[model samples]
Target chain A: MSKNLVGNHIRKLRFNHNEMTQQQLADKVGVTRQTIVALEKGNYSPSLELAFRIAHAFHLPLEEVFFYGDDPTQ
Target chain B: MTYQEKKSIVSLISAILIFGFYCLYMYPQYPGGGLESPEAFRFWGSFVLILTVVSIVAHIVISIIFNIVFRMTTREKEPNFADELDKLIDLKAFRNSFFVFVVGFLLAMGSLIIYQPLHVMFMILIISGFISDVTGSATKLYHYRRGV
Candidate 1:
């Protein structure tokens, strides 16, 4: 499968935040757990509004939750 | 598999079964006159119309049953609403399904241009509709398993 450029730290961040479950984060962001699963697996890129919602769920800035390349900026 | 994947598979199977059983049930009722007979046309018309209604109602019933069964078996409630990912996947599935039906429609029309019998056109159209339904479900299954 081709790689998706839009990478996210949702999985790690979810763990950092009291080991939040996929369902919990999904509820926080107003999405299904399947969407969170897809994001963690790099199988989907969220729309801007959804991305913002996810970021907000993590209490992080957009860039802190998501990155545009294979590697995150230091 | 996730609920979406299971639902997609159930849908695909249901589409095939519904079309197959409907065809089997209706096959013997075809008019015995010439294919071009008005009675033949009437049979074909009612076949398509009744099939449409039957399939729609059957699908709705099957979906409800599937959801109930899924919740009972998995002990998890199905998602209450569609989210962005669900909508996106649905759009993609619809696009593919619509494309298939359009192609099939054109081919069916082209068959008439080639001097094929009217019954041939009717069969083609009916088959196309069934295939399109299957395609939509299959597309959803593929994307759900492989991710969109």
Candidate 2:
């Protein structure tokens, strides 16, 4: 079975959005700061609703926030 | 650390301490040289009852102290809800611990086939349950530290 990888531009987005802290972003998306830290570190994959909420927090489209593919760093 | 992580650490430590005490003190008191004993029922029944009460009170006090210390040190509010990641970690931990419990249970039953002692089986069952809980909490803390 092939593994599915989900990646995000959370760190970049946070920087672009006036250098928002992980806690701030987490607060915006109604999640714990540890979740945001995990997302930024690529240690976790967010749910679809959470993905959308995170994107909405930064006023970005879903694709701009997260991607699913082999190359997580891209 | 998250509240769940902190709670897991507390549980793991307390489980180890309690069970270790049980093994060192209570386990040796059985009439038989080994774990099997007919008279063990009364001792185990009261032992378990007292342990349960102590564990509950200890956990409550520890949690309260931990929360107060964490708030004072970090100056941060506790997250009111278990988020998706927290739930996911919990599910994974529980799944792993369930296997440990089932396997331990089967082994305990297998022991009964050989010894045929009901009280021994009951004691093993209780120990297995405690092992499952400790394993679950340890796994949750591991995931929190190492990533899920």
DockQ of 2: 0.48
**Residue-wise C-alpha lDDT for candidate 1, range B34-147, written one tens digit per residue:** 879999999999999999999999999999999999999999889999998899999999999999999989999999999999999999999998899999999898887777
State the lDDT of candidate 1 residue by residue for A37-63, as single tens digits: 888988888999999998888888999
Ten-residue stretch with the least lDDT total in model 2 chain A? A1-10
The C-alpha TM-scores of every prediction are: 0.96, 0.84
CA RMSD for every model? 1.3, 3.2
Tally clashing residue pairs in candidate 2.
0
Clash pairs (backbone) in predicted model 1: none
Q: What is the lDDT of every predicted structure here?
A: 0.91, 0.81
| Collision count for each candidate, in order | 0, 0
TM-score of chain B of each: 0.98, 0.77
